[model samples]
Target chain A: MIEILLLVHLILAILVLSIRSLFTAVILMAIFSLFSAVLFFVLHAPDVALTEAAVGAGVSTFLYIWIVKRTQKEVK
Target chain B: MTTTLAFDLIGYLFVASSVVSLYRVLWGPTIPDRLLGLNVASAQILAILVLYAAKEKLHVYLDVALVYDIFGFVGILALTKFLEKRHRKGE
Candidate 1:
């Protein structure tokens, strides 16, 4: 079960790098943080999981989305 | 014995379904479609956590899942707000 989640993380990281849009990449990164938090929980580190969920998924995602919005090109 | 096996199976199923949602996130043509996929994936993740916590009889995992739920909600709220603001600016 844990192995499968790790595999998903691997695949998502590769997809994040390969995506063309900055917005999609940011969203993918958010998903990455989520799965990693789960991974930490399964590994018997509940405290780490909590921190990862709060900072990685919550704070960082908001910050990345803000960055993307500030730098994107307007569509015609 | 049977109950444990059933819980294990359901957990795997949820994970698989989340992977399927990832396909949409990877190939979605529009921003909203990707966001939809992301939302589905996060919900599925929450389900998995709850299922495992029940299976292992751990209360701490439940708290982790709760924090995860709160963070996911706030993150999505912020994301959509940013998107909405961008959309308005585009007009």
Candidate 2:
């Protein structure tokens, strides 16, 4: 299970880089953060898991989206 | 023993994932892409810290994760806000 999770995580990280859309990258990173939170909880760090769940998965993505929103390419 | 082994396995896996995300931070074409990469790496680091705290049975180390959680969001939020301001000015 650990190996499988690791493989998926690494692949997704690579996908984030390779993908063209910044929106997709933000979403992918949020997903990755969720996975990391689960991984942390499994390891018995409940506090950290909670923080990652709330902050990384939630707030960070919101901030990224906010930035991405205004910086969008001007439609010609 | 099995549980400990499992924890170790998962922890290492997260660490490896963060390493891969570093490439995006270094070479991303757009600023948002690079920030996205940074966000991923920092989130993983928080998880790694928690895993380490569990492994060492040191509850206090969890404080680092908490602190990181607070500051990480603030920093990112501020950065994005700044970007938004600059972007609006450009237009």
Candidate 3:
């Protein structure tokens, strides 16, 4: 089961890497980070999961959005 | 069994998103966009590492994750500052 989960996680990671839009990528990455946090919880690491949720879903997403806003260029 | 399966599903979702994020990093027109992608990727990796540490029952990996968190924070701040400097210089 874990193997299958890992496989799916890997596939999603690849998908994230392929998308062209920055906004879309950031949103997707947030979703990805959330899942990773869940994975950590499943693996019996609540502390790690908490960190993931805070940093990945919260801080990282915020940073990306900030950067996107700062640039004002949506193309490419 | 159900719990494990749930985690598996979640992991797959994360993998999918990470893959999509790569395109942004590869073709981002601006440096900040690339930096954002990189930052998101690092966060995801940190999560993955923590999960692995738990699965493997290794406490040491937690330390690695902590270090990664610090490094990632500093790195992103540095990059942001650099970009701000460049933008100001361009003005």
Candidate 4:
């Protein structure tokens, strides 16, 4: 049901936010964003869902990965 | 009864994650970590808006979510560019 899906999404979001590795964080965040978009759709907000899908899954993740690649060597 | 319980459960889950995201924003080690936490929080805000829209049977919240989406993107891009500039200047 919706509750289960939401729980999974929350867990993923927590994993994304708490993980140490930048690369893994980006991937987990991408997944988290995708699920958030789906949650929006389930909540009957197609416009918000579309924006979330494009921005979260598409642009934000790409930006995060690009920055990670650019700054990977600097990490301690 | 089941449906109400389901909605309540999901709502609580969303709230819990939002709280955790706030914690990340508070204690994030680096600038990017802070930015990422902020971005995720905004995304969660959008999700909450969408949920409210459904619960209240109103479309106006969707508009707010759309605007928030644009603002979050621009803010993240600006922060990233600013960070990059600072890093370069430090080099």
Candidate 5:
């Protein structure tokens, strides 16, 4: 089960990097964090999961969106 | 035995959903579509956490999921507010 999860995580990461849209990529980055958190949990590292969930999925996504909002080009 | 099978079944389903959502994240023509994809991705992640905790019978994993819930909420809220501010600022 855990190995399958790891495989999924690797696929997601590669997809995120190869994608064109920055926003979509950023969101994948968020999901990537959750994958790591689950991986940590499966490995019996609750403390690492706690931080990954709190910071990776939480703070970083907001910051990425903020930067995107600030720097996004106007459509028209 | 049956319960574990059920849990794995649900987990696989969620993994598929996340994979499907990746398309939107990869080539969403508009910003809103991509945002929605991201939102769905996060929810599916929470579901995965719940399923795992239930199957493993771990109290601490549940706690981690709760913290994930709170942080994910805050992240989305902040992003929405930022976008709204940008909209109102006439950018």
Candidate 6:
């Protein structure tokens, strides 16, 4: 299970980097955080899980979306 | 021991399904579809947390799961609101 979760994390990171849309990348990042939090919990670190759940999944996602919302797309 | 094994099996099932659901997020034709996939993924994570808490006899994880649900809700809400405003702005 741990290995599977780690594999998923790697896939998400690559997808975030390769995806065309910034919005999609932000959403993928939130998912990445979600799994990492779960991984922390599974590894017996509930404190880190709590922090990651709040800061990574919640605050960072909102902040990223906010930044993405305000920025203009670069011209090709 | 069987119960632990059962919980492990269920966790694997949830993980597999969530992974399959990522297909929607990756190939989604629209923003809302990706958001829906994200919602599904978070819910599955919450379930896995509860399963672990039960399996290992750790009550504290219950609180983590609760807070995670709340955070997922708020994150999705904020994303939708941002998308709505962007839609109104025409890009």
Q: Please provide the root mean square deviation of candidate 4 (C-alpha atoms, Å).
A: 10.8
Residue B64 miss distance in model 1 (angstroms): 0.9
Residue B40 shift from truth in candidate 3, angstroms? 1.6
Tens-digit lDDT track for model 6 on A1-76?
Answer: 8999999999999988888778888899999999999999989999899999999888999999888878954323
lDDT of 2 at A74: 29
User: Per-residue lDDT tens digits of candidate 4, residues B8-71?
Assistant: 5766677668657755654666656767776786676567666666665777656656655774
Q: Per-residue CA lDDT of candidate 5, range B2-49, in tens?
A: 998998899888877876876786577876777787788778877888
lDDT of 3 by residue, B5-89 (tens): 7655665666566656656765667667777777776666666666666655778667656755774565456456645765897
Q: Could you tell me the C-alpha RMSD of candidate 5 in Å? A: 3.4
Error of 4 at B22 (Å): 1.8
Off by over 4 Å in 1: A72-76
Predicted structure with the largest lDDT when compared to the true one: 6
Between candidates 1 and 4, which one is better according to TM-score?
1
RMSD of each: 2.4, 9.7, 9.7, 10.8, 3.4, 1.4
* Model 4, position B87: C-alpha lDDT score: 90
Q: What's the lDDT for candidate 4?
A: 0.66
Best-to-worst order by TM-score is 6, 1, 5, 2, 4, 3
Q: Which parts of model 4 have CA positions greater than 4 angstroms off?
A: A1-76, B1-5
Worst 10 residues of 3 chain B by lDDT: B74-83
Best by DockQ: 6
Error of 4 at A24 (Å): 24
lDDT of 3 by residue, A31-52 (tens): 5675576567557676787677
Total backbone clashes of model 6?
0
Alpha-carbon error at A36 in model 4, in Å? 20
Winner on TM-score between 1 and 2 is: 1
lDDT of 4 by residue, A1-76 (tens): 3675587677777776677767556655755675576577667677787787677765787677678766863335
- Model 6: CA > 4 A from native: A73-76
TM-scores for every predicted model: 0.91, 0.53, 0.49, 0.51, 0.78, 0.95
Worst 10 residues of 1 chain B by lDDT: B82-91
